[model samples]
Target: MIEGALGDLRNGVSRIAHNEKIEELQSEFSGDKPHLQHSKPLHLDPMFYEALDVLHYVEPTCLAAFLKLSQFMHRVEDVPNTKAYMESDRIIKWPPNRW
Candidate 1:
């Protein structure tokens, strides 16, 4: 689980870095305020879809790991308790009074 989580995080970070690189390249080529032609989205880019597939595979695992990590970190940092109020007794409060 730890390995999978790390792998997914690594992949996600790499993807973001790649995207930033692409954006930088585009900006370098097309100066400030590049004119984007309003046209239908290109459907021929299989790479785009392939990236999406990788994201789909990694997203859930990444999210779960992130949540776990966040909780862990929070515990380590001794974050304040923020839980909402709860009813005293679920069975007594939820059921009908007649019962």
Candidate 2:
């Protein structure tokens, strides 16, 4: 029961995050209109906290995977050569060390 509730909460938060991204992109392309900017730090802090809240209810492996995926997505834009890595048809190599 608690696991289900936590899953729902996670899904709700994910939807909010997705909507915020969509709005930002629309604003960027539409030009000259103000768009709601989602606070990354604010959002992330709450998200991490919420994840922690339900950590006990969730499987350790699942939680670890979720966190890893979230971290990857958050750092996607800032990583060097991200576009090249994303667009490559062949296997792309990453630096031995990343930020």
Span of 10 residues, lowest total lDDT, candidate 1 = 79-88
Specify the highest-TM-score model's number.
1
User: Residue 54 lDDT in model 2?
Assistant: 40
List per-prediction Cα lDDT, in the order shown. Answer: 0.37, 0.41
- Across 1-99, the per-residue lDDT of candidate 1 in tens digits comes to 868866765775586445635444433543443121112223322233233334445463543433333333233223222112122233232221211
Cand. 2 TM to true fold: 0.23
Cα lDDT of candidate 1 equals 0.37
